[model samples]
Target: PMYFFLANFSFLEICYASTTLPRMLMNLGTQRRRISLVACATQMCFVLMFGVAECLLLAVMAYDRYVAICNPLNYPLVMNHRVCIQLVTGSWTTGIPFLIEYTYQIFSLSFCGSNQINHFFCDVFPILKLACGDTFVNEMLAYMVAVLFGMVPFLLILGSYSKLISIILKLPSVTSQAKAFSTCSSHLMVVILFFGSAIITYLRPNTRHSEGTGKVLSLFYTILTPMFNPMIYSLRN
Candidate 1:
């Protein structure tokens, strides 16, 4: 069931990523492709919504790990049928509103000049960068998104891992500790890649990162990280 669920999520990832990335790729090849205003708005909504949902799912997966390893005896009891419903529902609940805010911000902005976004997908920052008119409102909304979507979930994962590490250290043998660390290290890597790029892009103190750097780093989380998850996890184990 978990496999099926993750497969569905990954399918959505491909659909969502393709909606924007494919357009960008086509534009790169042809040197002239433009999104209709409505298409751009729709693309941004799906991208943002799916991205947020993926994060919530990752956090829930982390919580599942916490329950499974820390209390195996009660794992089934703790993550019961009804509880799983609530968890998945909560992910959608949190994701949908962010989508609304993002789309609202995007629609409110004026795009007069070239609407060519450098990076794949109609991501908030890159789209906002091209907005011709006053983008103060969009910038504020972006900052709010940075806080809610980028930082908070990252802190949640960090906090969970802190306790997870504490529990791992309590294991009696070095071999046991190594085993736990190996399983955890992949998840830790994903969390790092996802949050690291996002924070550097949005929560940046210094805007020294170049356009090339921004595109590459964003690809790590959005395009590459999801692909890496299964490979890294399987290889590590």
Candidate 2:
């Protein structure tokens, strides 16, 4: 059920990325690059919510897998019904706090002059580029987001996978080792595809890049990663 739920979460992520990218591509292709304030705000909200949700859910899934694979006898005892509901509820609950900060920070931004954003979606960095007034608060908020959403979850996933791999290596038989890894291979692959692209594309401290190249690469995690998830996980598994 948690697998399906988290997969559902990723499915929503795919849709969210799809919604913004096409219109952005159309604009970048034909130069119809004008977007309204309302649309930008809405885009900001949806992208932030879904993107953060994906990160949160993936971390949750990793931890769930940790409990199941590394400590099977205790799995049912530990991750019971109440705990599962709390995990899901906590995801949504922790996710909404960003909305309050976004509303205050983004709504207050003055877009008086150039309104052109040079990215596919209204991600914090690209969207902030179009703000008219001082975006110090927005940038600080974005930095906080980078630390909390991007770095922290990544650390959690890494730690979980580390424990998982350690447990797998302890298995006595070669076949058992392979089988242990096989259960998580799908998730491990998904994590690599998503985070690898993200780290390469956006996690850079210096953001200089060429035209269309960055946009194309940005879709790897957002669009292509989700598409690959079911195929790699389900078909292979």
Candidate 3:
């Protein structure tokens, strides 16, 4: 089950990185930083789709760890092949409806003024800043989506790890506790890097000063985190 979850996660990291990096590299190489409105919207849709999936999938991974560590005797039965597939499927599909709607809402807005996006990619806040009319509804919707997709899964990961830590501490032998901790430490590190940067990027107020900071933070989760995930997980081997 652990490998199953890891395999899905590794694939997700690939898809996630592909959504932004290829375009980013193309723009960098050609020095043509412009993207068509349709293309930008398409990129945003895929980014949100994979981003939300990654959040949910991380929580699912955390739950898998919880079952393995805290319910070792029944781990195989609890995380059987069918159940694992269901969990992964749910994680990937759960946010599609909300994200599609969210992307449509943002792109449907009347964008005017500079037209140049402030960030490297078509992120929510940067795109919202370009809209001509009132964006209260869009801003509110972004917050709602952030809370629903970002915070909810983040809290689940925290809860799972909290319970897992308690259980590990209560184990009889130091070696057992160490082994248990080793299984999840890589995941814990990833959760922190991914969610911490993501929450900061999404939940914070959109301001002129923060745009630069937001881009930097976006690089962490979108680029650096994905780049580091394989190294982080491989070390566990």
Q: How many steric overlaps are in each model, in order?
A: 0, 1, 0
As a whole number from 0 to 100, the lDDT of residue 102 in candidate 3 is 86
Q: What would the C-alpha RMSD of candidate 2 be, to one decimal place?
A: 2.6
Candidate 2 residue lDDT tens string, 1-237: 456556566666666676677777888799877777777777777766666667777788888889988889998888887788777667656766776567557867777766667777666677666677788777777667756876788899999999899988988999998887877787778778877776555555535554365677678866787778878866765
Rate residue 146 of model 2 by lDDT: 59
**Which ranges of candidate 1 are over 4 A from the true structure?**
1-9, 205-209
Listed in order, each prediction's TM-score against the native is 0.85, 0.86, 0.98
- Tens-digit lDDT string for candidate 1 (1-237): 244335545665676566556777788899776778778788878877777776776677677667766877998898887787788778656868767866986778677887677766667777877888888777787777777876778778878888888999999999998887776676677677766876786766424357767777778767777677667656865
lDDT of 1 at 39: 84
- lDDT score of model 1? 0.73
Best model number under lDDT: 3
Minimum summed lDDT over a 10-residue window in model 2 is located at 202-211
Q: Could you tell which candidate, 1 or 3, scores higher by lDDT?
A: 3
lDDT of 3 by residue, 1-237 (tens): 889989999999999999899999999999999998888998999899999999999999999999999998999999999999999999999989988888988888886688888898998899999899999998998898899999999999999999999999999999999999999999999999999999999999788998899999999999999999999999888
